[model samples]
Target chain A: MDNIEKLKLTCLHDLHVALGAKMSPFAGYDMPIEYAAGIIGEHNAVRNACGVFDVSHMGEIGITGEDAEFFVNRIFTNDVTNAPDGQCFYGMMLNDEGGVVDDLLVYKRGHNDYLFVVNASNITKDEQWILRQADGYRLCLEFMSEEMSELALQGPEAERVLEEVVGIPGADLAFYTFKEIDRDGDTVIVSRTGYTGEDGFEIYGSHPFIRQVWQALMESGRATPCGLGCRDTLRFEVGLPLYGNELADDITPLEAGLGIFVKLDKPDLVGGEPLRRHKSEGGPRRKLVGLEIQDRAIARHGCEVLSPDGEVIGKVTTGYRGISTDRSICMALIDARYAKTGTGLSVKVRKKTFPAVVVPKKFYKKSYKA
Target chain B: MIRYSKTHEYIRVEGQKGYIGISDYAQKQLGNVVYVDMPDMGDELEKGEDFGAIESVKAASDLIAPVSGEVVEVNVALTENPRLVNVDPMANWIIAVDIADMGDLDDLMNQEEYDIYCLSESH
Candidate 1:
């Protein structure tokens, strides 16, 4: 069968087609890349106003039982023990070798119930990993990816749209917190969390409820219908690590510059020993850094980074001519010695080389609500 | 006369010189052109050969030559504002070249043929 025949479609697929969106296959799903307004417009809308993304393709897993909290803390890098109900922690699940299996968000719904939102592409792998790690624990896991649909209403005007347009009371939510509300017999989870650096709410509910909210927001004309195209650009600008790009199976979170999230002090944490050793040994051999290209040519993924003497030392993970910043920047994994800010390097884009300097990975500062 | 390649590039023939740019449909598909990588003046481009590339916010595409020619001038304005191609792709020709052979034009499609070709591909 052809790729399209095997691809999955989200609940918003028909709506996206009706809106003249450019559809493409992403993570085994037929996803909209952009609407007629284009990536730049959609991107700017989220930066300056409001834009909503159909994030239904993301995987949702639920864990509950007497040992849910302990099971989660053992598998997750972030400390969630005794975390208050409705608190969410963002961290990674690492393999025994300390390489990242997936970066995910664990929401502490209550004393023993947790919700996990993971990348769309790593659903199967993550489910199997979670199941394998759940052995000998008194916990029940539910993969609710197909049963749920999610929308991310993001930007400066996101909270206003959530209140006025979607008619959801999300203004009280602090950053990284979530609450479940019963709306017309359906449980809708609204969280003040998003991939974009903007102040946003990620609403999760049944397909029908999500479709209703999407229609309400679209009909009200308060939020632009965004796609995965700008979603990537926005996240990249904020220095967020995409799983396959910045944090891969071979790349550790410590090397990806996410040491703060990895709680090496947490007792019996999976992969904690190696991570401690890695930290105690000064750090990983390679490190992720930001490179600001001096030329107009875009430095794309896998482009080689070279020293001034022309020795290859690194490769670009994610690069873009940033929409908000208007500067060509990229995140690259380079030799730790050359990962220092202000270090001069060059990137080979196809046939030409451009001068670049190591800078902070965050090309744009986040405007998340305090 | 304007002739089109299956790759969506168009060559506008005028005397012995030809101006080349991507079609309007191509620009809409590309969306928000960020950079256009063009060959320098006097660079030789062969028929069906890729001479340069075009980048949008999400992805990049190669600019394939429809016919052989020597680059006489590159669109310098695109260096400053590549979105000019998105605004008016035909008006903002990417390069002007001296035709290597007028016979090369015979291999391209006309307006009607290219439109139908695009329609079939879109479906």
Candidate 2:
């Protein structure tokens, strides 16, 4: 109800139905929101063991040309030039005012070649922006959202599961790093990265190769196919932001506590001075904070947050009762004064207010393989 | 006389007292009812006002009052087996109330009339 209908189904549509997933519309895709095994079961599965996801709906764009790193480094807020070949760096593209354009993963294929992993909804917009910027530079940028099918094998046992399928002991790929392995002795890229706040690899290959890879990985990992419903809660448990919820066009990275990724001191970069001003000016008016409700009342998105004495502060961005924690928790965008840990607060559930406490952010401590 | 509201609440009037529950349509639409909280005993409710709420895995929706009344008795069965409403919502009344306004009766629909109303929502 918080979003509109923008669903576009992928190759796993019938497979999801056959497995009894509850389908829902999300990010211009008709996706499996969850399996009938439920969000709790799916959520715990990804947290404890391993799980598979048909994330082919996410967008990917490629850049090639001389000085490609110069063009990419000029654009994203992340320090991508320092990222060696066969590795990825999480960063965001920003507007002139330093508001987030989109948060993405930048993969450096070589000195002058790069790949951008962007959110599904921003594919068209990001392509247009990248192409417009490419006009002056000697870079060739291409949107490749359709060329790859993304599958996530996430949990503690991710490496063990993938080693048998990838057959190369990809366990050597460090966190935020990737390697190309042999599929019939031909290379396919497997990156040890994830969005579910778990340890895993996101596999990318040709479309035909994905089906067999999916079956083999699922069989080897013994991971159940998790839907986006559990995916949202799983990520939220560890305080990883959703595209619309945490990273939006109007919200600046400084405001979202994402200033860590932006290197304002870098020489002659895009959006540098503006970011410097935000950094020096004591950050934004609102900051993100974690919350725990006293009651089982779920403080969902758009719910108003107030002080214990009823001073209105802000609103909830995302919320859920953790199946792993067995506690009702949420994250909110509140006045900087209330962002402190252990501040007493209240959330409006329907018509009544329930007491909650501002706890630490990243409620679930993720132990990914480093 | 038994009556129903367009929003899917059912009421059975016995003298000045009335019993309230949700219709089958409401329960079916809200799958796998996880929790229910009804109006407190002796609580006053205005016609069409929220008197209770039902939460499911998917989402949550409130139970509206069919007629103005003072809540007298509530079904404790909902606490343990809330899904009973989806199976036989009409027979499983959630609240018994003392009617606060008799004039509101004209706004309610009988079973056959309510079925026609439910039909309009069908695609």
- List fnat, each candidate: 0.83, 0.00
RMSD of candidate 2 to true structure, Å: 4.1
Model 1 lDDT at residue B29:
83
Tens digit of per-residue lDDT, candidate 1, span A44-110? 9999999999999999999999899889999999999867899989999999999999999999999
TM-score for predicted model 2 compared with the true structure: 0.85
Q: Residue A330 of model 1: what lDDT?
A: 94
Candidate DockQ scores, in order? 0.85, 0.23
Question: Which candidate number has the best DockQ?
Answer: 1
Displacement of residue B93 (Cα, Å) in model 2 is 6.8
* lDDT at position B112, candidate 1: 98
Candidate 2 deviant stretches above 4 angstroms: A1-7, A165-168, A182-187, A216-221, B1-38, B46-49, B66-68, B73-123
Instruction: Please state the error at residue A362 of candidate 1 in Å.
Output: 1.1
Model 1 clash pairs are: none
The best candidate by lDDT is 1
Tens-place lDDT digits, model 1, residues B1-123: 999999999999999999999999899888899999999999999999999999999878999999898999899999989999989999999999999999999989999999999999898
